[model samples]
Target: MIDQYSFLRPWLFCLDPEKAHNLTLSNLDRAERWGLLQRFITKPIADPHTLCGIQFPNPVGLAAGLDKDGKHIDSLAALGFGFLEIGTVTPRAQPGNPKPRMFRLPEAEGIINRMGFNNDGVDACVARVRKSKFWQSGGVLGLNIGKNASTPIEQASQDYVFAMAAVYEIASYITVNISSPNTQHLRSLQSEEMLRSLLHDLSEERKKLSDRYGVHKPLFLKIAPDLDQEDIHLIAELLVEFGIDAVIATNTTISRETVKGMEYGEEAGGLSGAPVRAASSQVIKTLKARLGNALPIIGVGGILSGADAREKVMAGASLIQLYSGLIYRGPELVNECANALRR
Candidate 1:
């Protein structure tokens, strides 16, 4: 079966990355409407795991970028992801960078994108999730929120707080995304001083929302894979100090080392896929060592196979997520990787 599906890859790889992504997502949406996706693909692995006060049927999750606006949650959920993360949603909707902003590095099983955090905004995203049958199922759903592109760095925390308040009602977990490389100066938010202040404010907001809604959802911070050991240690210290519920060990990286000679390697955005495995694993290991069971870590980046998934778990990731790997390996990758974890 996997061999038969291999034929689809060459054709999918031929199109531009962004267009190929839209086409794939649209096809999945259609498959869900016809009730055919499940017949063809097995359901996600069902070994339940708990983290940060929520239960996930499996450690495998679909990362944030793939379903940015919460538009295709039902369809994506049907593809058998244990958890779905939607959006790098901002306070206000904004059109991101101009076309040809996404590139594929097939040679490295990687993708480079500078989409600039394009999305339909937090309110619309929350509304879509609320309306979706997927959310109603009580499946783990994470909202990855970011600042609007035009927002100044000084006021970025305001945007995070605003989006958090807007989606707190429906989100199973909320991820504070300060690592997207496409946005101008967004990574700067990861600095110790800036990150401490941001998490401090967001932490207070989470408590208030928990009290008001009578539910305490985990708040996780998503950092970049581009950080060095020093950077990871500093951020981990603050994560502990701020009482954050979890750490999403990585977002896409700005490093071009993996796809050095590829045509798209020089594209100006974050890179994700096979090449990121080593760097991302290092981040997870460092965090686990520093925080030592105090904070859970969601390992993501370059998870292309079962071995890669197992490596992350060994490195101390309580859960794992994939975006670029799914694009390259297809849905079977999910079950294959999860089954490996069970062993």
Candidate 2:
């Protein structure tokens, strides 16, 4: 069956990456509705790991960016991911960057994207998750929320708070995304002062929501891969100081070192794939070393195989996520990686 689908790759690859993505997602939605996806795909491995007080069946998770609006939770969960993170959703829905924004670096096993936090807004995303049969089946879902692109840096906290309030009731865990490079000055929020203030405000709001909803979901920080030692240390300190639950080390990186000579190498956006493996792992190692197990780390970036997943675990990641890898490898990649983790 996998071999038969291999023939479709050329046709699928012919389309622009963004269009192909939408078509694929739409097909999966239809498959679920027809009750065919579940019968064909292998069942997800149930390794049963715990993180942020939630029990995940396996350590391997589908990273954010693939399902921006939680629209295909059932389809994704059916593909054997241990957990699924949906969105870099903002307070309001907005069209992302212009066309040709998502580019594939097949030669480098990488992808360059300036997706710019595109999604159908927090309320819509929350509503879909609320209606998801997958969620009703007790699947673990993490909401990755970010500020709108036009929102000022100083006022970014308000956007985060708004998203949090909207999705707080439905999310098993919430990830605060402040590292995407496509948005102007978004990464600046990672600086010491900005990070401190942003996290402090969000932390206060998280507590309020927790009490109000009578549920204490873990609030994590999703960081970027393009940070220096000082930047990493400061962010680690902030995570500890602010009582943030976990840190998702290393979102897509702006550095094009991995895809330096590729066709889209010069594109202005974050690069994600095999090239980011070492950089992201280093961040995880640094964070774990700094936090000393005080906080759990969710490692993501450049994970293409089980070996990559194992390396992340050895480096101190309690959980692992993949985006580009899935695009290049297909659904079997998830089962293969999870099976490798068990060994």
Candidate 3:
């Protein structure tokens, strides 16, 4: 039951946020191994939707950043996610920003993390994916890629191209992540000039990879929730122009207007959860208006309930994803959202 998480939240909150995060995943792995997960977790509803040539079992998905290394794929899939996305992974392993980089704002149902792209690198993540039963069975997995922290912003395209080539054959679709706020200057890739160049390079690389593999893998761009009307319009135009498969609208927000005056409210990082629900929806609604059906939108931000999930669809998202919501609502939230989005 979803209330199981409510019971456990108090104890988890007592520990440091990152430590609690790791402990939860570690225990989940054990539970899945012992066959306890399938017994306790509800099965996801069957509501298949096809986009970018991949058939999703349901519209609700586990967003990237949770399983940064593909370490808990089989375990997380047991919780009823229709699809699972992993990473913000880079070309090389990284230690990330520093300790105490993640903060929780229980009063506001939000989390702020500047963990950078802390991951074990793309090669390791690829190996883990290859070993996964889910991937072996052709699960719809999206590999979110990014550049190394040490790489200059000007040469970031090289890093994206390198990572994309590594996961080309294994991924259901590749998400070019250029919106994470944690990495210094990472968000600069969103600028029209820089974005155009990056997209050009990625498109060229995709052509070569597709010809080599004899199958076309879709590319989806992940954008921030912190853009203006002008930026949104420009991005929508670019997506259509480049023939991008889909767009993941509204990553974590740097704006703290909603959670101000609360504990850890002023922490320096992108804020997610309920505080971002409205902003993310607004972005989805605007993108839908501009892009229409020329491109699909994968809405992911502060979806904590079935109603929130439906709202994303109402704003024209073909699919939805969850991250912080899992921390607050637990595994049952997956089934709840899937059922709500079922037509």
Candidate 4:
């Protein structure tokens, strides 16, 4: 069935990209509250897949950065994602970079965003989750955490730990977002020494949180797709050594090779969508070869269709996520991917 978003896309595209994003989500929330989504949206086929000790209704999920505030969980969940991972939320609220920080490369079906982890803070997100129908009903929720821009890079671990403690009770799993290129000095955390140090701190903290809550929540590390072979291998080794429960093969790429001459192609932010798909798949492929079953890979990068979703799976992603794809495609893409992946 054709999705309602296809019809709305042209009109939405006319507005500023960031405004269009906020408007679409805001309307979705209102539509959901009015009980109109179920009547129009197709439900995703149930293709249960378990990862990190949690059973998801389907393998398709909404990637982080889409709903950074956790304000639209129920509305978005109504769109048929098997799970929803919200935020690159930080310990404290931040207004993000500035206006026009998000740009659309329509020709390449991609987005360049330097929103800089804008969020209403972790405490606010946890409060929002508590009231959401999805979270209340036990829908799988992954909370992505990051450091505040004001926090020095060396003390980034403190910000992460603070946010982790806040959301630990509500999140089905926690994603350490150390790879967003928009943040200054953030990707440096992906380097060997910094990554090892950060993971060590988080690993030890997880033990304490698990003991305190009497529940073990998996930790997922979201990495950049810009790394070379050596970087990928070392990350794989560190993930296992640190006992991280899973890895999100990619976040977004700083590379503009695919969208070079297109409008806003030269924008300085992570380029996500069709442009980053291949690189993301390669990362998943390498990680799967090295980590095997020892670590589950949650593949996410440029999935815009069911075929794209399958490619990630073929590369060994146990599950897949969508963001820019959702912008270019529509809500129906969720069902398309879920149906394709259904065994």
Q: What is the C-alpha lDDT of each candidate?
A: 0.89, 0.88, 0.93, 0.93
Query: Between which residue pairs do clashes occur in model 3?
Result: none
TM-score of each: 0.98, 0.97, 0.99, 0.99
- lDDT for model 2: 0.88
Weakest ten-residue segment in model 1 by summed lDDT: 1-10
Q: Write the per-residue lDDT of candidate 2 for residues 1-343, one digit (tens) a residue.
A: 2554467667888999999999988998898888887888776558999877899999889898899998899988888889999998999989988877998888888888998988899989988998898898888999999999888988999999999889898998999999999998999999988888988898899889989989888999999988998899989888989899999988999887677777888888889988899999999999888989798999999998889988898899998998888777777778878888898
Task: Mark the 10 consecutive residues where model 3 has the least summed lDDT.
Answer: 334-343
Per-residue lDDT of model 3, residues 1-343, tens digit only: 6778889989999999999999999999999999999899998768899999999998889899999999999999888888999998899999999889999999888999999999999999999999998899888999999999999999999999999999999999999999999999999999999999999999999999999999999999999999998999999999988889999987999999999799999999889999999999999999999998998999999999999999999998999999999999888899889988884
Cα lDDT, model 1, residue 3: 62
lDDT per residue, candidate 4, 156-230, as tens digits? 999998889899999999999999999999999989999999999998898999999999999999999999989
Q: How many Å off is the CA of 213 in candidate 1?
A: 0.6
Instruction: Arrange candidates by TM-score, descending.
Output: 3, 4, 1, 2
Please provide, for model 1 over 183-251, each residue's C-alpha lDDT reduced to its tens digit, 9 standing for 90 to 100. Answer: 899999999889988999999998899999999888889999888889999998888888888999789
Worst 10 residues of 2 by lDDT: 1-10
